[model samples]
Target: MLKRQEVKIVGMGGQGIMVIGQLLAHAALIEGANVVWFPCYGPETRGGLAECTVIISSDEIGSPVTSTPDTLIAMTQPLLDKFAPTVKPGGVIFVNTSLAQPPKYRDDCKIVEIPANDIATELSNPKTANMVMLGGYVELMKPVKLESLKASLKEVLPEHNHRFIPINNTALDKGAEVTSR
Candidate 1:
């Protein structure tokens, strides 16, 4: 697996889209990689678009953005539709099939579809769908250690929110289970 990664994560507001970006950033930092987390949000606070780009590299990074990412984590159908073509050839795309229909046209890249929302619901925390997607990506590509991401939850989440760590960890583990060979 490559240590250098450029990832784009997308979902609606309040879906922990930015949280997973931060988790990746922190996980990269923990692994001693240069990293950047760039977030973009739509006008509406909770229902509109929420997305971010995460760059992780062992070498010094020149930018936090990428037009062609190594991976795409699409938490919604609209985002999957819009960004699937932006992934580079042989790259990976993780789609939340609970909401987004599978892409029918592209065959250049590997597509891993996980019903993240359904998985999260099974875990009793719908908010961790983003983490589910992240977990699967981490399991498949190993951009960072799974333990690093587990350790990063505290840093990415607020102190008052710490109580949810166990569930989040479980969600991540469940996600990994789905993709583990």
Candidate 2:
């Protein structure tokens, strides 16, 4: 059997949106899936729109861009509003309850609310909120195992930043824990 996932993650700059998307792409590749990570950047470097589309599939992928995503990960209210309507029916939306709430009108999809920022703060860095969201989405969707994601950190992150891996791992676990509850 083959598996596929089209994920659109939206957030502002400095939120590590691209990093999480890269993490997923790398993890998927590690699991023998062909993957693509396409990121978009707005005018401003910070507090500007940052979105990434990650396509992971057992077979080859023809397009890196997706008009409709099977999974939507929204880190803020505006981004959620902008992308919520585009998720395919029966898809899942992993929301950062610390910043965005699930849309009320979208009954066709499953909404998983995770207080990502709060969880990351509790873990000591608030910046790892993206990892928290990744954990939640991975727990629910299983596009790639959480362990695969953790392993990718070594490859994705620069050597000097390797020290943060432990907290990042904890954030991932915390996200899984919250979703399991």
**Top model number, TM-score:** 2
Q: What is the C-alpha lDDT of each candidate?
A: 0.90, 0.93
Ten residues in sequence with the least summed lDDT for candidate 1: 1-10
Candidate 2 has which clashing residue pairs, if any? none
Error of 1 at 45 (Å): 2.4
Model 2 CA lDDT for position 134: 93
Please give, for residues 74-144, the per-residue lDDT of candidate 2 as tens digits.
Answer: 99999999999999999988899999878999999999999999999998899999999999889878889
Q: Find the 10 residues in a row with the least total lDDT in model 2.
A: 1-10
Any runs in candidate 1 off by more than 4 Å, and if so which? Answer: none
Error of 2 at 128 (Å): 0.8
Error of 2 at 43 (Å): 1.3
